[model samples]
Target: MGAWGPGIFSDDLAADIRGDYRELLEDQVPDDEATGRILAAYRHLDSDEVHVLWLALAAVQASLGRLDDEIKARALSVIDRGEGLEPWQEAGPQGLARREAALSKLRTQLTGPQPARRQVRRPWRHVTDLQPGDLLARVASNGDTCLLRVARIDDQRVGAAPVIELLDWKGQALPKDRQLRRLRPRYRDDGPHRPMTYRVARLRKKDPDWHDAGFERVAQGLQQQGDDALPPWSYCGWSQLGDEVDRLVGPPKAAQ
Candidate 1:
């Protein structure tokens, strides 16, 4: 499945997955014994090998979704480690995000509803459609919202995902691999849930004049007071303002 023994993975671990699986295919080992040997091999894997082994296992599985829960659990265990990792591992938020993305892409490719049972899902437009300087509204996990501008778009392999760069109201760039989810038109409360399950829509195209009425009123006030400057505010206030704008005009049309 990976580099042979004494490298990132142990000899026993590699043998069980790469070798024992083959033995099972050849009828040299019973299914139960092969399963035991494979489970035992997991014990020999170090933190570094966890990811690789999981990926290798996924490669051999006919349906990645079958192992989706396990994959997330084991990947999180290694990527979210509290203790320090070897310097060579380059473990950090960015690295973790990239690895998570790889898993997401793999799962997307490997699993889906059967043709007869499938319903059309909301198609997520390509992030590359956003050009630099184009405005957007981003709603955070807490339901707070903020204005954003496209800062950059990074192209990867021909068929790989493109990284979208966004500049917040303060001009701070967010991590490229930060996960973005689509907001559904309706909602339901099904008990306790992870925050990731809830997503707010990302708005793109909008009428610049949508805020004109409010701005015009403010402008009149400023003229009467002979004050050209508006009240100072931090990003927190901007979030509320962004939310209001979204509510007033509705979500922007996504770029094609």
Candidate 2:
């Protein structure tokens, strides 16, 4: 995996496993079930990755006060065997020293008494019913209503969110069906042949007012050829939808 440092979680795979494990717990999955799911999810890992996975999971479990004997024993075994140090060894003596020290500290922590398990309340995750070709009307704070076309949907472990492209139509009133179908997606100006902008929007669970967010589905089943050629953008909070759309579309043109 990609590693930036010598810590146990310095590697991408380890860090991802830690996050996934904790998310499972937060979703009210029993510790054993969560551990089983994580293990099953990574069963494809080879020898080296297996070591990293077990160690990362064990460390996370310990910190969360849910460390079971099986996982702790497996992690300690990997550490004692120095099974996952191939990359560090290749990094030269200093790197190897740092990695070994980190492993040693992890071993000590694993063997120590862990704190009592903390209660985890299930979190409300953002859920979207939008699909490809669906059109949505987003009302901005300034009373400008923009049309956003759902180019695709990204369904991850967290939830589903739309990958949307802002259409070249914005007005005080939502557009008619004929107008929406004729509208082209706004493209970023700086690129050669200007590429259409795409962005993912997900409702923020922490935002108390997310339910009343100004998004409404207006139409569906509109598609254009070569839409799949557009580049993807990372997900943004629904609260930032208007600003992101404006940034992508640039300043509005002067009144014709």
Candidate 3:
């Protein structure tokens, strides 16, 4: 089994993440900025978007040579900002013990043998560069891989962002009018929206090695959105309920 740590990544990629954090430090962005941004995303985004953001950040942190402190801080911030309440928060000593026991059990489950993660490559940086037939990666709530094929680009002006039709690996178009949107410029005005900015990279894959019935389920879930429209995560994967809460409250591990 691969050791429990950050996955392998190119030096250039690792340097890029380091550079981004360094710039944030240089610019004097508050340490809570990352945490705050994550909280904002949790508040504004749907379940799938939340999963994608968490998974992507976990991947980046893993690639960063295991900067445990930085990763731990971000996770703790999410828990705190989300206003989580351990039983102890209200139940006193008894609740504290229960919470600790629950947490310990969860840690064991999370650290159990996990399936190998899909190996992904660098993706197109610009949305405009995407072309029909390109495959992108989407992560499910359980951290499974879902590959989406770009069918067409709809760059018309009428929405918050341009939409791209995507198909599953089995040649089935996602239900409804589901589409992928590039990170909008609006979020960049005050500062780079980490979730929005990194979404383009997070939602796409440079390789196509997935074939599973889960892809059909993914599409059907998006179709069920009706007039609501599917969030980018619909094209990607599902986020298991308790798993997400666990990660938000503690140091993140590879989604699992």
Best by lDDT: 2
lDDT of each: 0.35, 0.78, 0.35
Candidate order by lDDT, decreasing, is: 2, 1, 3
TM-score of each: 0.26, 0.72, 0.20
The C-alpha local distance difference test score for the whole of candidate 3 amounts to: 0.35
TM-score ranking from best candidate downward: 2, 1, 3
**Which residue segments of model 2 deviate by more than 4 Å?**
26-29, 128-146, 151-155, 170-176, 191-199, 206-234, 248-256
> Which stretch of 10 consecutive residues in model 1 shows the poorest summed lDDT?
215-224
Give me the runs in candidate 1 sitting further than 4 Å from their true place: 1-16, 28-33, 63-101, 109-256
TM-score of candidate 1 relative to the true fold: 0.26
Q: Tens-digit lDDT track for model 2 on 117-157?
A: 98866555666767789887876544567788887766666
Best prediction by TM-score? 2
Model 1 lDDT per residue over 1-256, tens place: 3333213223344334644444443454544464456557676767556565554443333231223345435434444452223432355566545545554554554454412312222333323333333345454333344433322233332211111122223212322322221111121124432111111122333322213212111111101121122111212222344454455344554557
Model 3 C-alpha lDDT per residue in residues 43-156, reported as the tens digit of each score:
664542342233334444343332234544443443334322332465566655554454344333233443343333233332344443344444444444434433334342
lDDT of 1: 0.35
